[model samples]
Target: MPEKQRYTLPTKAGDQRQLGELTGAACATLVAEIAERHVGPVVLIAPDMQNALRLHDEIRQFTDQMVMNLADWETLPYDSFSPHQEIISSRLSTLYQLPSMQRGVLIVPVNTLMQRVCPHSYLHGHALVMKKGQRLSRDALRAQLDSAGYRHVDQVMEHGEYATRGALLDLFPMGSEQPYRLDFFDDEIDSLRLFDADTQRTLEEVEVINLLPAHEFPTDKAAIELFRSQWRDTFEVKRDAEHVYQQVSKGTLPAGIEYWQPLFFSEPLPPLFSYFPANTLVVNTGSLETSAERFQADTLARFENRGVDPMRPLLPPEALWLRVDELFSELKRWPRLQLKTDHLPEKAANTNLGFQKLPDLAIQAQQKAPLDALRKFLESFSGPVIFSVESEGRREALGELLARIKIAPKRILRLDEAQDAGRYLMIGAAEHGFIDTQRNLALICESDLLGERVARRRQDSRRTINPDTLIRNLAELHVGQPVVHLEHGVGRYAGMTTLEAGGIKGEYLMLTYANDAKLYVPVSSLHLISRYAGGAEENAPLHKLGGDAWSRAGKKRRKKYAMWRRNCWIFMRNGRQKRDLPLSTTASITSYSATASRLKRRPIRHRRLTPY
Candidate 1:
């Protein structure tokens, strides 16, 4: 190690430094160390939601500090539908802790950090805390719930919903997973019991319960009036036809109205960073700046296209989100940070913890000695190896696999248990493994022992399919071939053509019907087309536009579907003890369709393969 390059964390309240080459799960370990040394909690700004969630699980193995993940809405920037109740609940719970969070880790995705959250005063002010022996006001509490954006329901099953019947009141708090059953003795103090949402049975007792606002923004009369006035001032449009304005006037939270979060408050909406304590440290990783640029470009495109629609107008991107420059300005405000720079090459520094990545163990399953490489490392390695599996089930499965080779490993829960040189089993969410030379320990995961698999990433955000989609592009078909259109029947395929319609240019499939009549269909509508395989493989007859033959073909398809469904019901009715049967599957339907296609001219024979 160099004289200046040390492994110690940032000591000051606000300091910006660089950390690099800290690959794989070592990032989580470093983050855990920072939180312990700093006076305030550490806020990790992950590149995406998947990366944030992975660190949230792995960091706990290193530190006992409270770890929480501030979840994203998982909806697009201007999506019409609101986020799920559970996601909102998780977010509110985490936000409530941020203000006075003495020490811990808060993982937030970069995209989520850009959006403006509810004002800090709004969340803390609206929150209601109740203790077991505290007196309860039935009528006042009911009115408070309604004003706080909670819905009155017949049964309390989801968060932000409450059900009341006389003395017994059931309410699912925004921060809690289960509904609480409160038994009130008139207006005096009573008991609070946690109950199951599904079975409606009491599970246990609780000393105290913290109740957060049902929605991020308040929906009280003052908030609504403020929103309506701000909407008029900002939009400067006719409000009579706008559904959002109408609903706000009536104190109704319309679906997808979360996009208009800025309008709900008379004061300036605060950025996500404002919710954190002033002295809190923020860390940056990966290509966050590039990702933010991509997100901004996408949002701008949506803004331009959505301008024409009067029913729901979009707020300026700057109003709802912070720009990349603004994010960096906030990042520099943190007292302790390890920010990754895109332009400059990293030098050896105090922040950098030199943890080498573990070498891959290519386990050949087919060979007699599949564990040869792993065995060699286990025997030669000087430090203890903590093998971290993604889940408890994977840890058990790994133990069973290693036992065949006579390598009995001891299972432990924490990193402190790996004291000496040996194999230990631990469950974590590490994507890759690393070895800390100074600590004399190495961390490995299931992917190291096994091999890589297709890791699932964030799915609900903006996903752009190139040139339409894989299903839309019929690149397998030659320029000249017979194709079947669900609505227009048989046509001769003539490849794809691009044209401008309504001032928007797009690709379309060019198909020619009988007598040289041509039809152009958008490439996006590929679900309406299929390969022609009805009468003969190569000699599919082209149906003329506005012809009877096309209508007859559709009728035949409907009958075949009906017949297949009826046959399935008949077989299941007289089954030989069919259990755990799937109601229906696309594969089964496709198999039946293929078999029926082979014998189109005759009655199809039923093949019995049990009821399921």
Candidate 2:
């Protein structure tokens, strides 16, 4: 080595100044010092392709044909899902192999282009350093993440994502190989590593290397196999249903055929899919100043404008894919990102080409512990209370407890059952022989876990009830009292609103007979109706819908949700109707049917044989 020197460049106060605040002049000076000492091609690594391109382009000015970006080279594409070699050769080999006619400087984004790069091949085996604070349990870290201003970002990699399955905690962070695995020791972090998301096994260490945002080998064999196995069962059921449907249309199957056997149940399918696809995700790298600034501004805007929480936790890493053709094309113009060469093992190089779906790791949910804390929160409230929970088991337990504590048996209603039955089921098993005053207690239970896997269930019962039902239920004043609302179709009385609108007036609500419509009934209409002949819970304090209490409560809930949406931008899937159209038409069948019908028809004389 000859020598090395350090220098700092002054930032120019202009709009078009380079983002890094350095110019090509300074870069050329640095390259000259390195070139004089180096014997061969120089290598550069960048966070993104754009930076790689900039560095390569800048260096090219001094040494006419010196810099060459690997992304600019042409290579066969490989399917990322299947095993394939991505790295073609080292920077030295690439330069040595170049034709005599192609002599120049070599520049490449080391990580992005090293498709063949795997720690397994490099180090063979090296034990990663295991530190105590470094290994955090999903639940423990989630609390920290809550304070970190990170949540699920829809378009970015799952940065602060956590998920649990029984004892296993999966976290996919930016630049880590595989998602990090935090096996629990009684809800504590026992061990951690970048494990294969599919296999759930610790990735065999190739080399002790710094993690990257992009995954070289993200697919785990287990997740893929699980999907493949389940697909056949799904296809068979679909095929059978199609046959049955066609037969019924032809008048072969009876009208009650559908009632005999339903196509499939809804509860189990969502979790199966949830385990894999949601794991592999790519986060936006913020490669550009404008992009980074946009993200920051959005965060601030949400906090100030929407009252969003800034202390949410980090979401999981998202697996972003680069198409082979597009990858090659962009490299020619801007050679910065390291696009891996098709140097995968023979088996991998010849693999089929297509987009492989990877699990978005951002959705890993912390376990049931957090909800326990929330339950304790509701216990502190002594007034006419309204609480919300996620789990059905928790709801049932609460209902049982409230029945024993309160006197009015009719006032305690379990809303979960009402969701399935399409009506509110009031179970006021109060010990005081039905306190027929006002319907006071209202409980709302919500679970992110259930919502994660509820979409695939064929039954309507498992589907989330509309927010309106919860609102309308709060408007009710008494059990067995008939109440009507403009929005909700119709529902029996359940309870009154404990949700306040902060200090705003005219925001109180009464439970009504409707499906999931919690009517925000105004408090000014207290004198609109009389109690029913046999209504229970009638004597409790009548609340004016538009009172100050309603306003305070409503604002609080809004603030929490606004913060949540800002942090976790969970994208909702648009439902599509699956219609099976005949791939081929049969014109001959139509002609045959017409001719056969004509032949079968006989011209009957107007008078004689009709009497028979």
Predicted structure with the largest TM-score when compared to the true one: 1
lDDT of each: 0.72, 0.31
Model 1: CA > 4 A from native? 1-6, 236-242, 339-352, 391-393, 404-406, 453-612
What is the C-alpha RMSD, rounded to one decimal, of candidate 1? 15.6
User: What local lDDT score does residue 163 receive in model 1, on the 0 to 100 scale?
Assistant: 81
Question: For model 2, how does the per-residue alpha-carbon lDDT over 234-306 read when each residue is reduced to its tens digit?
Answer: 4332334334333332323222221111121211211100111111111111233343334344434443453
Candidate 2 structure lDDT = 0.31
lDDT digits (tens) for residues 37-137 of candidate 1: 66788888888877777788778877888998898886778866677677789889888888998889899888899888888898889999888878878
| Residue-level error in angstroms, candidate 2, position 15 | 23
lDDT of 2 at 361: 15
